[model samples]
Target: MITIILICIGVLFNIFGCVGLIRLPDVYNRLQAATKCVTLGCCSILLGVVFHYGLSDAGFKALFAIPILFFSATVAAHALIRGAYHFGTKLGEKSVKDDYKEVVK
Candidate 1:
């Protein structure tokens, strides 16, 4: 029951992430959406696996994978966004402010 609910939530988040990737105006926004939604989705799916499997081998693996997935996804997304900014990717027209501009100068 709970496992099904978690899996459904995960699926919804993943769908939202995909939509964000297609709908967002700029690379940064897309990256933010992809990173946050996908990470949460994956983690939720893994949590469901853990719940479904209890203390079995699959559950143990999911337990170990959760933190690793979270941290790595966040770090990877930050690195990609930073790299894109350094490489001269422009912000979208709707973007209000760049917090990094003064820092880069």
Candidate 2:
């Protein structure tokens, strides 16, 4: 039962992430959506795997992947956003503020 719920949640998160990728306005926003969604969705899936498999090696592997996915996604998103900022990919005109503008200038 718990495994089923986790899998459902993971699937929904992934779907929402995909929607975010399509709906977000700029590269930075898209990266944020993709990173957060994928990491969270994958983490849930991995947790489901751990639940289903118990203390088996595969379960352990899935458990280990959760942290790795979280950290890697965060770092990768930050790096991409930084790169986009450096390259001057203009934010959508609807953007209300530019937090990095002063730093980049």
Candidate 3:
């Protein structure tokens, strides 16, 4: 029951992330949406797996993967966004703030 709920929530989050990717105006915004939402969604699904399998091997794997996915996804997104910015990718028109603009040379 709980597992199903968690999985359903995770699936919804994943769907939101996909939608964000399609609808966002620029690469930076799209990447932010994809990274945060999808990472959280996957982590939730993995938590569901842990609840379902308890102390089994599959559950342990899922447990370990949660942190790896979270950290790796965030780090990778930051790196990609930084690279894109350095390569001269511009932000969306509606974007109001750019902390990086002042910091990065």
Candidate 4:
């Protein structure tokens, strides 16, 4: 029931992330989509596993994995984007403003 719903939601997020990777114009945007969607999707899937398994060892492992996945994904994405920006990766033509430009300078 709820487990199935959560799994479905996670799958949808993963699908959207894949589509974003294909559709986005630049590395930064692609990284943003991949990081956010994939992190949420993985967390949701793990939560579904926890729900299905109760508080057993597997469930406990899933619970512990959630926060680790979230934080690591966010941090890694930020680092990658920052590195790309510093290395002179240009934004897409449609990009309006670089809020980081002033901060980085």
Best of the candidates, lDDT:
1
lDDT to native, each model: 0.94, 0.90, 0.93, 0.93
Which residue runs does candidate 2 get wrong by more than 4 Å?
none
Question: Please, what are the lDDT tens digits per residue for candidate 3 over residues 9-75?
Answer: 9999999999999999999999989998999999999999999999999999999998899789989
Better of 1 and 2 by lDDT: 1
Q: List CA RMSD, all candidates.
A: 1.2, 1.1, 1.3, 1.5
Error of 2 at 16 (Å): 0.2
Q: What TM-score number comes out for model 1?
A: 0.93
Alpha-carbon runs more than 4 Å astray in model 4: 102-105
Q: On a 0 to 100 scale, what is the lDDT of residue 73 in model 4?
A: 93
> Rank order by lDDT, top first?
1, 3, 4, 2
TM-score of each: 0.93, 0.93, 0.92, 0.92
User: What lDDT tens digits, residue by residue, belong to model 2 across residues 1-105?
Assistant: 999999999999999999999998888788878988878989999999999999999999999998888888888888998989899899987889887788787
lDDT of 1 by residue, 1-105 (tens): 999999999999999999999999999999989999999999999999999999999999999999999889989998999999889898999988888988764
lDDT score at residue 65, model 3, on the 0-100 scale: 99
Q: Indicate the residue-level lDDT of 59 in model 1.
A: 99
